[model samples]
Target chain A: MTTTSTAPLGDITGSEAALRGFLAGLPGVDQVGAEARAAMLASRSVKTSAKSYAVDLAISMIDLTTLEGADTAGKVRALAAKALRPDPSDPGCPSVAAVCVYPDLAGTARAALGNSTGHSRVQVASVATAFPSGRASLETKLRDTAEAVAAGADEIDMVIDRGAFLSGHEGRVLDEIVAVKQACRGPGAGRGGEVHLKVILETGELGTYDNVRRASWLAMLAGADFIKTSTGKVQPAATLPVTLVMLEAVRDFRAATGRQVGVKAAGGIRASKDAVRYLVMVNEVTGGDWLDPRWFRFGASGLLNDLLLQRQKLATGHYSGPDHVTLD
Target chain B: MTADRPGDRLTVRKTFKLYIGGAFPRSESGRSFVVRDAEGRFWANAAQASRKDARDAVVAARTAQPGWAARAPYLRGQVLYRVAEVLEGRKAQFAAEVGRGEGLAAPRAEEVVDAAIDRWVWYAGWADKVGQVLGGANPVAGPYFNLSTPEPTGVVAVVAPQESSLLGLVSVVAPVVATGNTVVVIASERVPLPAVTLAEVLATSDVPGGVVNLLTGRVAEIAPWLASHLDVDALDLTGAGGADSDEPTGQLAGELEAAAAENLKRVRRPPVVPEDWTADPGMDRLRWTLEIKTVWHPVGV
Candidate 1:
């Protein structure tokens, strides 16, 4: 079933009243059916060559991340190096799509990764707008996005003001996202590409699948290049059912506006099986359209090693362990 | 469904499944094997765990290792003693399963069941004392205070004894967990009913989930995967050779040991001769499943 609305989304974000009516009118998510469908898709086995392909695809799609308060330049560089060469032993292994880090460390990741951008190049993604907790002023949030963009972040991952959105002041939230998107268009730190803005709803704090759906639409309407699920800091982050609801929103968003936005399921996704399951859901739920790294992404740190290990096991006829892979 | 009921009463058969992550789950492969008694009668159908089940058990054991290891050693002992108490309560059912599965007399089965319960209590006592016995201050030439302590070696994959079943399984498992290591145990393929019952005992006891994941399947089929698994810290091949002479031969044990070398896993090879489970289990298993962590502090004042 498709989740598209008949009304055009060209001017939905022009006013707060129109934005709220559109999100409320778009569609309500079926929690049970969404969860059951996700669980059912999780059980579908993609084995042998299909599994091998999934592993490589998953490896390439990882936003190899490290966002601790104690993150160091050395740690970001090391993570960047791993992203550049995920499997040092096997040169044939694919490099991850990007290296995600805090805004202050974006330059460290960018410097370590060198001047690289676009589809195949390993981009640096930074979480800004007082990430994990978007309880910041609009001026500070804009400055946060601008600094990451100025520091050579190819992509800006901004968190929505969930407090404002939860209290029914979604116009303020939408205005913040649009402002951040504008900030992403500012000076490009010598990198010759548009800084993609990924809007994080932090679905865990949103409280329901209906809210998650509305948030996805709200983000997409406010010019989000990608709609993300979490900030990797909350419980119930990036769950399959929530991602399912978001995927439906993005799919229907494309149908309504003829502009396709990406979906990133970040936080708490660390296993190869779970990553592959997400890929399966993407395949079945949205067809093959969202299978590419440009359209879909996983914001995870430990997930890369597991994908590598699974890749190694497929190559060799034995099960691989964490010892065989680089520690993230 | 049976056609006739003895004494006009129907008996409900128990479903034997693999115990993983503190839950009873059927094998992911959806396969079950008909277990026969010593007299070759249909005993029950036991879940035939596949390689995937073994893999899942390793993941569960890995997840539970840190919390299981972080608990105070004394508290761990109490929890294990609690397991012994629970096992004691289920003694009759275990005795019946062990008797039929091992082809032993009812009295002998009861003895084996009793020995298994005592084994837990024995290891439970060792839990708190093991540190004092194994860890100590080391002599250092430098002006430093050096201390050595034994820590759990992470997830251990144990192949339980095929012939002895109850007592031998307890002998191998209790020691590994007693020292704080979580284990993914491959129960005796021929006789695994007692191991399932033991899993139930562990579930009811204070022993945390994922501490002891039991898989009932071919040891040879599952051992190589566990042996070669990078996440598994140690492997016990006690039942590498077992009840069925056709499976898990001595050569397979050597191959498993070789596979374990990939990650430098601590491997306890199968005994040259059948082991006496009733004999005192030396600190060998405990030591094998533990890593000595030495810390040095500068001597001041």
Candidate 2:
């Protein structure tokens, strides 16, 4: 038996009114099936060479994030340097995909990564759209997104207004996403102004697999480059089932429209094994297309250390600790 | 999937888990390794604690340190004595398990378990007097009363002996916790049953949760993590090079020592002399696990 992808996402809901019908008409998610599929994928054994490869790949996909209230420029610079060189003792550990921070610190992170040794491959990703809690107005969320993009963030992570999405307001969610995606253009829209937009559904608040599916389609149809699982602010931020639901959404979306979107399983994934499990799910659900940093990312802070530690163990036959890797 | 199917009585199996923060939790990594009997048969699947488990243990130990250290020394002694009392009651079980794990005769295993319980009793008595013995007033050429005393050094990581699974495990764990330091112990890999049973004794005793976290897995896999853990104040390398006695285990000990250097963890090496486990351990066991803090007060006219 073959698994069925979501219906071909051809601009059926291109209009505000038409999109609601399209979203409502889309197939509902079977929560048990999604959860069971995620659990089975998580149990997939990845060892030795495969583990080492997954470790490196997971490290590269990490958006080394620090969203604390006590964040300092010094802290952001240190973290950006860590993203550039995760393991100082071993030079071979690859640089992370990006350094995620609040919108205000985007430029500093960009500058720090730019000044890193050799040419820097790390991108500066900023959380915008009123961030963790999307309680603000559309004007406020747009300004936040525009500021992050203008401040040199290569990517913007925007949180949807759960208040609207939960209240059965799919059109409201779509409008916000479209506006944020437009704001991501950063003073130059379409004319080489390409700032990727990662729409954070904050699945923990969305509350169900069906909601997660709706949110994914809502974000995709409106022009999001990536569909992220959480904002790391709320409880139950990221889970296997939620990421699985999102991965399936992205997979089915790409199947429907020829445009490939990314999926990030962020928050609470602190260990190498957990991250590897997410990678396993990504492989089985999204296939090879979403395997790289461009198509998949981890929005985490402390997870990089474990990945580096495991990487060290694979290399030296002994596990490493915080002193050997970045504290973040 | 029973070995003997037709109308055979099934045996009850044991779940080997990690003792962390006073709770029995499986390793967060959910990884387990097959621990075998000395005869090379699958005995049980023991939790293979990952680096994250070591980190969580350090966190648990750190969180438990202040309160456990602040408890009255006499009361601390009582709690430790409680551990011994609990162990005494469960002696036969530990003896049987340790015997099976170490491939030892039942009589010798019983003797080892007895020694382990007695070691706890020894440390229990030392809890109250340790300060008076290790601390004293220092005379200086100043008009000030200066006193130096030994305080529990935060969290400690101990590797229990590979061969002396029970007695050696207790010997290292008892003194460290007796002086008020919380410990994260890695029991003998193939013989973690006894150590886990000890954790149970500790939980039911007055010992607080997070006071002693026990992990059963490869020292090579988890020891370096404990060594470099910033919150871990010291490391007992007593079980560093265990029964395997290979070149890699020695190099692992060296690597653990090197990793401990960054945090400046007071590293304890195995005894220079082959001392008997049954022999009474002097203050030497408790000495390195303490920190000497000196405070001075002005003499009033």
Candidate 3:
């Protein structure tokens, strides 16, 4: 005797049509040409919340590329020292979110950040999952994630297997993502040790807007706390158009699942204008709710100076020399 | 051009069948619908594609993807160029079809046809050069050599533009196939005769069987299936619904977005204003056709 299963098949899921209808009716799609211009003008005069704007103003210094010498740990300590010092006159100066370093130096950076003047405010982020290039086996990647978390890193930046994703082995990529996320989970919800997982799609690698959309969804479905643009090791690493695509993915995912995901535009983000554009994109696509530093971050080493310059220009009404403010 | 005489009779120069899996066949549902010209006269009876036709087109596109992607870029360029050549030869036929369907003057219709052919040639040149401009070496900090390159995403489903039938169809399909991704294009429901004729050109242009499958049907019926198709990696809503009608365009865009949510299909939202067929090609096509691939080898190597 054969047992017949009475489950629905194909695209007959109950909520499919409704969800499609909701997406089609989204405020952005319905409004034609004039709506975009009107929205832009409306945003210009609107006052952003000061507390939220402060977070948006926070920038994270990533020192992954500085781990070149044999004394990698010592270099991390020195970098942490520089990142933690306070500017006397500007005590109200907003602090950087974290100093991102390699996995090996996570502990050292954590200790330095813990003891520095701004110890309580700074976080220590570590790169894991055979980072910069995720060519390792799934088991190896998971081990790497667990090891980084064990080393006291607050956040883990991991790279996804672009090859597997491009080759349509989406299942394999998703599986690896789930396993690594499992590794990040602990005994207690918040106490077991909370580590955020930033899944880097490296948009530069996923060539088209469409592929970027697919990869972004895949990463989110697999449980990424944040979706990042690039590893900062590729050309076309971060661009307004590519970031716009990812932002749309994030927006759609949230609408579909009612889950909020973070976006990080990394790699070649060097100037303030680029950061502002990314901010605009996030605000426009995901709504104003995700504009804070907790939801949006710029992974850069050089952007601080430009942001400082722009901030000074806003404050003193005069351009200051690069020497006027020591970002280091 | 003929005079606008009150006694002039509407005549159909061609009737079209569904092009699926590199073969022309009647709709599985055996359905046909009469498409009328601007004068409210029936011009032709075109295939009323069924859900099965949509699936069949998906199958054809999926089957053709590997070979097409693996072909030399220059060879792909040549095949696309050949499509333009065939389209140029039948310029008058397409112009006449557009004239009746869109209510454009004869000269204006011919110009639209010429513009469509020119659009194909422009995309043909991009087949070889897009990769160089879009993908390249990355400067990694460690002792590892890394490079990023673009590759074709597999099978795409396109909802061709309703207003500019031939040009819109070519604009959507050329970019997709130019980058080695196979396509299943849903022709304009109001004007599908030209879409079927273009399929004939694709068949003879060495585009390979199944590379570009053309289906003539109601987009509302077929778009949801294509959008939600698990095997279909990307869906383009470039030309579906009337741009003038917010109700239908919004409804279609939302349905496609939600269906695409299942597999997270990449969706190119329809443009508010139809793209100019004769204008220089923008990054819109390249943005939709490519995927990023990051490669790593040991530092010293």
Candidate 4:
């Protein structure tokens, strides 16, 4: 009854040789095929009861992020507040998975989440490893992860050095991911308590689906709890095609190693319709296991209000406007 | 019918495609319905545009609205004038298409084409002047100044008149875009050939991509979406209840209005019967899609 794509890994712990070999021998993705699959999945219709469920699911999966240079403690607090109750008027609205902030603001978000009257289900996720660019050395990167973890980040999102990955420095990317994973597991200063590690490939910077697929495998094999599509920095960040390739990789990786990894498609996904399409893709590609907030996430700030509006529409049976929703 | 003719030359058919973001594409559904000439002969297979197509067109129109709206009023006028010039150049081809599509005689078809081109010219002339006439500074009793200025209401969706074909379609679309608004226009269902040709003229003109995306399909099938789409700010249902429309037409328009209410969209309900497309499409068309914003400022030393 177990149907899967690609060969099974059984109980093998994909070591450097196996990891490298598995990655190197990883079948190249057909560009047109991947794109076509994404497009087809995007067209799946989810309406009425299903739509209500999806809008809530998408809102729940959002990482309510504010990663701007002008980010302040007040801003993080407001964002954390919104994360806990996206629609203040409607108590039925589910809280977001986490409030993502810079390493410095993780403490701010954590404090805000703690002080807020709402149930503190919302986690504080921080972008580490020099974020967007990942240009720093390993020591700086590890310290960055440790800093966010120490500052009360429940999840650590680390961006890979795309420059290295593109130039065939796979070992460097894998080593950094492993070290960052360890940094998240610290009490070693566990103030944050086993911060989940999310490896961001910044797929827009990675040239092709082949590189994206290889990067996905490399991150998962090196122990990424979640394989994220983008840093929300590059131009073509978190495209459906790229996400589709990554989702397929995770699906295959799980079939092989029996170790399930989550997938996060972040950036450029603004509207409820677009988010719904991504959910549909997840449902068909990864099935129900990855549907929860713990696995999937949308890294966006503007996206929350729209989801709130859509959620309100489902509640009131009429479309809601921007005036009705609180702006974070 | 031509099976008996052994040496007949194969007729070359033009594939009618949907114009979205200035690019001609077949419907995402890839399903097309046969559009016949007035004589009931197959004219062409117009793309049976789906909800997805309507959504895509709105996205395009939304994307282009800001840049198009920000253009200098005089520049927008000139660009619209350029569109008229393109249409004028293709007048002969358009006339022939309209003649066959609407079952009109050559002379009447030519007149319709002329009127359509002139309609564009009229709207183009209004682009720079409408704001001046519609907006003004309001004198305040207190030591303050208030100014009311007309702004384009972003993306507007138009269900083009099915009766008049070219002339009616042009009349509805030109005014919407003239006031800085971008539009996703649905062509006349039975007579879409001329509108498709008009789209070709628009694509070649200075109209930015997405400023005037065109979809050729049954309006009833596609309009519910544009009405419900949250991104679309205004809607012109001029083509909704034409002369050939039946009892359900009124209900359809009602449903559209109801859907538009979800977003509190500005809905323009046409007369029960199609308006005579050849008539002067006055300031009302332009006025419907324009938002008047009044700004108040304190008059301090």
Q: Please estimate how well model 4 matches the true structure, expressed as its whole-model Cα lDDT.
A: 0.85
Per-candidate TM equals 0.88, 0.78, 0.46, 0.81
Q: Please provide, for model 4 over B148-260, each residue's C-alpha lDDT reduced to its tens digit, 9 standing for 90 to 100.
A: 99999988998887778888888889999999999999888889888888888998998899999999888888998888777789888777763534333477888888899
Model 3, position B33, has a per-residue lDDT of: 89
Q: Which candidate leads in DockQ? A: 1
- The segments of candidate 1 whose C-alpha lies over 4 angstroms from its true place after superposition are A3-36, A117-119, A163-173, A205-214, A326-328, B1-9, B70-75, B128-151, B242-249, B280-286, B290-301
Candidate number of the best lDDT: 1
**Clashing residue pairs in candidate 1 (N, C-alpha, C atoms within 3 angstroms):** none
Docking class of 2: incorrect
Each model's iRMS: 1.4, 4.4, 25.9, 4.0
Q: Evaluated with TM-score, which candidate comes out highest?
A: 1
Cα RMSD for predicted model 4: 5.0
| Ranked candidates (TM-score, high to low) | 1, 4, 2, 3
Candidate 4 residue lDDT tens string, A1-328: 1133356553223455565666677778889988898888887888889999999999989998988999889988888788888878888888888999999998889889883333346888899999889999999999998888888788889999888888777877888898889888876445434678899988888888988998988888789999999888888988888888888888888887788899888888888889999888887888988898877889888888888877776776544455577766
Evaluated at residue A311, the lDDT of candidate 1 is: 85
Which pairs clash in the backbone of model 2? Answer: B21-B210, B22-B210
